[model samples]
Target: MRFDFEGKTALVTGAASGIGRAIALELGASGALVVISDLDAEACRSVVEEIAANGGNACVFAADVSDEDAMREAVEFAQRKGGDLHMAVNNAGIGGPSVPTGEYPAADWRRVIDINLNGVFYGMRWQIPALLRAGGGSIVNMSSILGSVGFAKAAPYVAAKHGLLGLTRTAAMEYAQQGVRVNAVGPAFINTPLLSANLSPETLEALAVMHPMGRIGTPEEVSGLTCFLLSNRASFITGSYHLVDGGYTAP
Candidate 1:
């Protein structure tokens, strides 16, 4: 299971905090030249500085993943900094307001769908050609356990995640023979700020108990799985979905 990404360049979106931040740090630590993109410009810069201080090559770019123009600019920034972009983690997304699907606010639904679905689409549509020119690469879409199943109060979020999985599968099939591997990571409950703020403590405990492991997972745990999927070590694992969900879906 030893995999190295030395000499490779990786672009990670939504990297200012939470899962995206964890992924970026892990990728940088694993020897990939990293370009961190986030809507929060300051946060992005901080991540780059931290990586640099830690002896990793990194640069930061700010962009709203939902904006096509922003996504393009972010890619260019990565290319300029890393020289060759070889991997992408389309992790930009949001959790829509919690409510019954029927009562979900239209604006919130649109916002979530835009960032979670359209954002990834934009990232891939633009990155694919560059990745091809760079001689192929791996892509990891950050879906959720909701991608595989429905959650009662999370209509828009569930829809977006499910869409992400479909997009990953379709893109992987389309590019497999061409040497690109596309995959999705569906984590159930990880200790990201998203969960801490958006989800209540009781809900978190309930989610933990739902897992056979009797606890939620961690960001580093998910990072281990993501790093594998984004490396040559997973050459034959395209069009796949991984569950790093503390056994939540196993039962």
Candidate 2:
């Protein structure tokens, strides 16, 4: 799908891989000056090079999303490279250890919350003002299907995702009159490098069965909806959670 992002600037966290990378590349292809951000500097550069090769404009910004200062610097870097920030995808996150709530370690819980939930908060802390300064823009927080429903043995991740929806809605309502829109995208199991590396073939197949479509989603599938929300086409859509879950949450 073609989106008109000419003269706009977009920042995508976790752009080194997975859905974030797909979104960054899509934004670049749509004519937005993309700021590819992730912890891996070299991987970020690689994504930028790919964008350039495709005749799109992009730059790299390496930062750990869990760090408030680093997130601030990321927004600043985006402004420095492409003027005011017009769009942002707070997509950086990590899946903490899988354990029952009773067995979940305090440190692991904090770490998960820090990266998955606090990270988005930190990104928006800086991004919201930047978007306002740009005369209004869009922000998409990458939530997961777990945001809408509970999954056993993933308490921290589920709790963080659920919290993100509230954050997204609050920000959306707060900025609605100001023309800055905030929304969240919830995706189900997606076939990405991280999933491929972590899950066995049998495990993946089992996951696919959970979706009504009988298969895991792709990063590009999630990116398409993300880019749509960021585009002007979704001007009236805000404070909403859009799911790209292949009917995973339908039943």
Candidate 3:
């Protein structure tokens, strides 16, 4: 699907790899000037180069999503480079240690919540104003199927994701009247470098079968929905959570 994002500027966090990378590339290809924000400078630059090679315009802004100052700087960078900020995708997240909540380490839980939940808040804390300043815009917060349901031995991740939905909804309601739409995209078991690095092939195959589609989704699949929510095509959408999970949460 193609979107006409001409004259629009977008800021995408954690855009150097995985699902974030896919969204950034798609936005750029669709004619938006993209700001690739990620902690890895090298990886962010690579994404920028890839977008440029594909006849798209993009720039890299390396920053830790958990840092409010850095996230603010990222938004400023996007506005300075691409003009008004019309779009944003808060996709930076991390899967915490697989341990029962009772035994989950305080440090690990804090880290997970900080990155997966608080980071998104920071992004929007700065992003919403920019969009409002631009007159109108959209924001897609990357959630997970876990946002709707619980998973054993994954309390921190699940909690953070669940919290994200509340944040998305509140932001949507507050800004919808102002022409800034806010929504969440929940993807399940996407095939990304992070997933592959953490799970063995045998485990991955097990997870694939858990989904009704009998396969884990691809980052591009998640990106398709994400880009749509960011586009004018979803102009009527806001304060809702869309699942691209192959029916993982359907049952």
Better of 1 and 3 by TM-score: 3
Identify the runs in model 3 with alpha carbons over 4 angstroms from their true place. Answer: none
lDDT of 3 by residue, 4-41 (tens): 99899999998999999999999999999999988999
Task: Rate residue 2 of model 2 by lDDT.
Answer: 98
lDDT (tens digit, per residue) of candidate 2 on 1-251: 79999999999999999999999999999999999999999999999998999999999889999999999999999899888999999999999898999999999999999999999999999999999999999999999999999999999999999999999999999999999999999999999999999999999999999999999999999999999999999999999999999999998
Give residue 160's lDDT in candidate 3 (0 to 100): 95
Model 2 residue 151 lDDT? 97
Q: Give the TM-score of candidate 3.
A: 0.99
- State the displacement of the C-alpha of residue 100, model 3, in Å, after optimal TM-score superposition: 0.5
Top lDDT hit: 2
Candidate 2 is scored at a TM of: 0.99
lDDT of 1 by residue, 1-251 (tens): 44688999899999988888888888887788988998898999888887877787788888899999988888887788777679999988887667997788999999999999999999999888778878899999999999999989999899999999999999999999888899999988888887898888999999889889999988888888999999877889999999888777776
lDDT of 1: 0.88
Weakest ten-residue segment in model 3 by summed lDDT: 75-84
Question: Clash number for model 2?
Answer: 0
- Candidate scoring better on lDDT of 1 and 2: 2
Runs in model 2 deviating more than 4 A are none
Ranking by lDDT: 2, 3, 1
